[model samples]
Target: MMKARIHQRPKSSMQSGKAKVGQWLLDYEPAEAKRLDPLTGWAGSGDTSAQVRLAFDDLDSAVAYATAKGIDYDVVRLGANPLKLQAYADNFK
Candidate 1:
């Protein structure tokens, strides 16, 4: 079984922006099924969307398959590409 996790946070310290981003993530469902985290306010209701996705596989073959399809790395090492979030969602299916 494979799993993908997506997280979204406000882009700034504005209630409106946080609400907007939260609503967007809540309503937007990518190709892969995802679980949304509870709405959390930081810096006193900020306006920013800090999102992330984690994809897991039990076997190397599965990881290879995901990578071949352009899936991003799960580990957050140096020089990690944020664009890989979509790739993870793409493989969620």
Candidate 2:
């Protein structure tokens, strides 16, 4: 059985504005353990599902897709994004 994870995307560190923070993402768990490649010594596996990332507008849509696809999934809910507002003069304190 395929397993997946659903979670909200957090604000990126590079941007001051929140973008796509409301989007939910579905990531498939790796079905097999990664093994070291003999030639390059890089970890890789035959399971391609781990590379797939599905985005949804909300949690319900993501969950619904998983349910309809018969994929067992776990949802990870995070607390609200913390935003601290302060005046420029506050930096002097």
Candidate 3:
């Protein structure tokens, strides 16, 4: 008999700067580019959040896609959009 190895999925952390950017895009950006939130469940009350990254191949493509999806601001707070968050990140870079 051959032994099988079990692989585990990595835990998602919002503490990482990369993750923070992804979260901002998912939450505030339009919608299309937002990836399904990795942390959602049937009994969880709502759909999982989504995420996006600045390092994506095409910024314009991502923005266009997101815009077509009809942005949702349910989880986003006032004065906290992707544009502003991105600006903040640039400062650190």
- Quantify all predictions' global Cα lDDT against the true fold: 0.35, 0.94, 0.34
Q: Every model's Cα RMSD, please?
A: 18.5, 1.6, 16.3
Clashes of 2: 0
For model 1, the superposed segments whose C-alpha errors exceed 4 Å read 1-58, 75-93
Candidate 3 per-residue lDDT over residues 1-93, each given as its tens digit: 111111122225545344323322323332233345456732222322323222223334444545566542222233433433355567887
> What's the lDDT for candidate 3?
0.34
In model 3, where is the ten-residue run with the lowest total lDDT? Answer: 1-10
Residue 36 accuracy (lDDT) in model 3: 53
Better of 1 and 2 by TM-score: 2
The number of clashing residue pairs in each candidate reads 12, 0, 2
Residue 30 of candidate 2: its Cα lDDT?
A: 92
Sorting all predicted structures by TM-score, with the top scorer first, yields 2, 3, 1
Per-model TM-score, in order, reads 0.20, 0.90, 0.24
Report the C-alpha displacement of residue 44, candidate 1, in angstroms: 22
Best by TM-score: 2
